[model samples]
Target chain A: MSQPQPTVLILEDNPGDFFLVKEFLKRTSLPAYEIHHTERVADAIKLLQEQEFHLILMDLFLPDSEGIQTFMKIYPLAKQAPVIVLTGLVDEEVTLGTLQQGAQDYLIKGEYDEKLLEKTIRYSVERKHNQELIMRSEEVSRKKLEALVQERTRELEEAIKKEKLLVDLKNQFVAIASHEFRTPLSTIRFAAEYLHDYLEKIDEAEIRSKLKKIEKQVTHMTALLEDVIMAGRTDLKKILVVKSKIELRNLVDKIIEDVQNSTRNTHQIELNYNVNSKEIDTDEKLFRNIFINLLTNAIKYSPGKESVLLNIKEETGLLIITVTDQGIGISEEDQVKLFEAFQRGTNAASIAGTGLGLSIVKKAVELLKGSIRLQSGLNEGTTVEVRLPVATTENKPA
Target chain B: MTTRILLIEDTEDLGENIRDVLRMEGFNVVWARNGKIGLDTYHEITPDLIVTDIIMPLMNGLEVVREVRAFEKQTGVSPIPIIILSAKATPEDHAEGLAAGANIYLKKPCSIDNLMNAVRSLIAN
Candidate 1:
């Protein structure tokens, strides 16, 4: 009713032996088969390469290969097919050797009747199929294990790299912080030494001047520590943006006054604004931090230069602000890394700054739904521009 | 003769303080606030001894030492004992300072008395 399940191969050189096998098969009650008869081992190898066979009836004595080794040549090629050796009476021991080398069973040339031959072929096919299934499953498991090992190795490599980076970052932080700590400590120590060396001979003016130096150094150190803490808060993801209504012109004016009071830098900060009363819903703390950072940068950079220009425009519910300094600007290479945390400009190494100012400004601006850009070049000057959408009660920052 | 010392540091207050202590300890000290100015002072004064800070604008301390070495090689001047008084505190930093041709390396926040002792020993030799 359907196609035969087993396609049997016969590799016998003798015609009488081949005829006896055909006669035995013809008398069997088994299903009809597509049998291929090859008298040469070479021809059997070619047939096995060309197509898959279910069962092989092989003779150890072939046209080109003889004895137990004759089965070895065809066995590798016809591994998909189960083999049964057909042997004469004198070669019974050699036929058993063939069975040991992956052949299923053997049939005596003149002695096997129809029922015994059918039983041998049926059981050989079953055993060979089970062996192939076991091999396929083992091959699959080996490949799966290799892939899993590769994936785990990659993950561990990534984790190790991250750990190394974190350690390097910690060392870098300690180095920078130690420098900051020393400057102020040196200042206080100097003041103490001056007083200790000349306590009786020094007048009130000298005492007042040294005390003022100590106070100023302490203030500077406090500001630096606060910046470090702010950077830590950003690293910890602890900054919360809460919206409050603020007047834009007053805020700028107030920040400018505070910078003037705190800094001894004599650079005149000019605010170019006509609007005095434009109110918007924004986070006041974030806004204050951003504006003050920009103003400090402007005043600090424009050291020999006279004026810092802060141009502000409030139009169409958008605030565009630009702060320009005619100070020593950043290089083209350093500008790309300027907004990254703990990165400083090449020209600012001698300047008393912790390199956290711009990064904090960047994060605060992002939280305020704003964008910041810098136009700077070496010895040319720097201009930092910022844009923020004036959100209403309905429109807000995330 | 008063031993003249050239001091290089970036921070204005710290430089003044260190100079004050050295001047009080009977050394004629000339101070410069940055590396470029300090290098110029070295060329101009050719002081008996030199003290410097490492992290400075323009030239930095190691660059100053290297340039001074080159200058001494060109002119064949007597080698000056150089001391690195810096904020960087690490054994590796100290080793680098020595390798850069400095005779002494002292980390910052050092007491005035300790600094005076170092200056006295170096200047006396």
Candidate 2:
């Protein structure tokens, strides 16, 4: 079977030149081609708009356009079609200028043979096709690079914003630490000073009360320091979950006992245990930290209230504990940032606190692969629920 | 008559200690737990001197000092001596306290002896 014909557009005004180019194309060893002829540049543009062509033979000096301008006019309309200029020997200089302006090749009117014409058209089309492919690939790669740069810029902006937030948090922590420590230190100093100055004049009961105040202040300071250290450890991701077998009921009872004694039995702590198995495998240290912080917070916030409650139960493969209090509860706005380090409720300003308790509890719960939820309202009360998977041999930390 | 002083503080233990020490020194002391209550007591009793904490609920020490000064200005009463006790110990904090009309700015954990001396001298003036 024969190859399909190549379509050609001839934009030469001279009939003699157009006939010569057509005859040369036929006589060449090229495949048969369809020819579309036009005498003026405008007519040639209209023909190009209507149909595509494999090649174009243009004359630099047409009736409506001339020289390099004629080639420029047709060049944009040529699209991917290769364009070769036809010129007389006298217009050699102008023809070379058309070549520079993207006319593929130029043939002198009578000096060129059919073989030369065939070779020129073949090479021009091939070269133009290769140039277009290179341009298209370059465009694709340039767009890909632009998208990559945009993505990197967005990532860099996010990192900068995070860095600024961390710096702000550090400054806030310093300010809070100074104030929290000073309040207790002031109390301790005054109590000690009073005891020294009035040792001989004060009664035994007064002496005991002053000493108790000093001890209490010292304990308060120690707890604050421990919270700061624990927060630092968790922020650094240095804590490891160490699972061990523990009696859950006894452990919780002991924590409640400790909290009650420390508060001097200021509030009653009722514990309700409904779990079937008292024995469980878990990280004892993390569990203790979680409950201690929760219970202490519940009692501390609920001044003048009678009691707080601790409830524990078990679901399939899950252990759930809830601590409820009838305290001055948290507002909705405060609860949003309650678990952030060094954040305190607006109502808590009158109450003494480092605002680190719930944050510490959150980190401990996360380490245990557990989830904590808080329900609270202004003056209504607060209930914190924690759920954890019961650690078995298969799911235990490696 | 015993010299009367108003002590404004929020921390329970510290406030109690200050009140006790002042009483031991033979000055009649009235304690208020926050700035609002302190201001109300200031109006009711018109104590001979005022001691206030900087950070508190309802109002702050600076606002208290400004209000007292404004009251003195309005009523043509003699300006009352005011001492500011604060945990913020920076030079800027001291300037801010004094600028707010406090006669003295003392950092927290200040020596009890120094506080007494300041109280005695300000009363004498």
Candidate 3:
């Protein structure tokens, strides 16, 4: 088989030594090779920069450079090529030093024959090629390890953030729960104690009023518990969206009636229904809770306002219900976190509330594939608009 | 002269119950619905003792205490004994209430006996 001509650069200052090395290379029984000759290190470096060679045969003592320094200058420019040191004397220490500093092999003058020189050149080229292969693979593995470490660090940071959010939510829940429960409990305790200590002094009418206050407190506590349980159910994804055909107007009327009865009908709620089709396929229980919460909130927040407006209409394929109150409105800061559990408006702090009403309403609306919007300013008024897509004929239960 | 007490609380039922109990104890009790009104009533009546709830609209109990302290400092009158009744039961909350110049901090739902004792002791002192 024929072999490609191997290019060689010979850097030697002495003309006689260069001729003898060239003669030895020509005598070797190998394939034809190309040789480049330069006397000074500067000219050799220029040639090394311009052209790539298969092997570099360098003399230790050049006109511009001497000893190990000569190899150091040329070694960087050698690139992938193997460098063989050619020395006049057989100094064991100097030869070992050059070898340690990445010199492929060292040849002595008047000692090595053509055969030894040929073998040395072949072995050095092969060893250098193998070393380059090992280095390239090591580089690839190092990059891969770095990328994997960065990805793991990102995932750990995300997990820590989620853990911190859960802890914050837990703390907020504890504070709200403790505060809400204690107020009513205190009232019950005070009323019971007052009656027990002053039973004879207080008449039957006063006794009945004290007992009634206890009952009212117990009812308030029960309602608070129910709100907590409902919130938990929604959080745990336990509430299922069961869509069925129902009269939307009737459902809303029933809800309004219940709210008015509970609130003692203090405020007049004017309902305006403007829809041709009253039937809608939706989760009845979720729908009831959503409007119940909205209507109750409208009445509760509008303390002195005599009336609230509930407008229901259909736009495109969506059913839009808006409950507007002409009472103390929510501030921009409070409105931002209005849907978050246990968040209450700063102005509404004095009002009695579990602060779970709006969050629960939001979750219920989300489950029904709807959206809610609120518009209000501090002390102006609040209007809550909920848009829910009416299920088409295909989605209707058979 | 009656041992007059100024009671500050937001909840109607709870406020009424406390007022009735204090009235039954023979102390002339004046109830204010919030911290702002409570502070105003404190100046008007100059009651023997002040019992205030911590969380209320217009102003919080701490602010009222600070304002009352500042007023007393300026007027050179003897500071009225103050007690804080609140649902905030955390150690940090207690520290804050006392630090705000309240004579005593009582968590909500405290026994009526405990409350009467505290009120009597502060008034007596």
Can you give the TM-score per candidate against the true fold?
0.69, 0.78, 0.70
CA shift of A193, model 1, Å: 3.4
**DockQ of prediction 3:** 0.42
Candidate 2, A390: how far from true, in Å? 2.2
Off by over 4 Å in 1: A1-7, A14-17, A23-33, A49-54, A61-68, A85-101, A104-141, A195-219, A222-248, A273-286, A313-319, A366-370, A387-398, B1-110, B114-125
Query: Which runs of model 2 end up more than 4 angstroms from their true locations?
Result: A1-6, A27-32, A49-52, A90-93, A188-226, A229-238, A392-398, B1-107, B122-125
User: Which lDDT tens digits does candidate 1 get at residues A272-367?
Assistant: 985544787898888998989998888776665788899988767778889999888999999998986678887786565667899889888887
Query: Compared with the true structure, what per-residue lDDT tens digits does model 2 show for residues B1-125?
Result: 88899999977888998888898889999998878889999999999999998876556778889999999999999998999988877799899999999999998888789789989989899
**Top candidate by TM-score:** 2
Candidate 3 or 2, higher DockQ: 3
DockQ of each: 0.39, 0.35, 0.42
Q: Taking the tens digit of each residue's C-alpha lDDT, what string does model 3 give over A230-339? A: 66553435555688998988888889999998776878999999986779988888899889999999988887578999999998989999999987899999999999
Per-model TM-score of chain A alone?
Answer: 0.75, 0.85, 0.74
TM-score order of candidates, top first: 2, 3, 1
Error of 1 at A114 (Å): 6.6
TM-score of 3: 0.70
* TM-score computed on alpha carbons, candidate 1: 0.69
lDDT of 3 at A397: 23
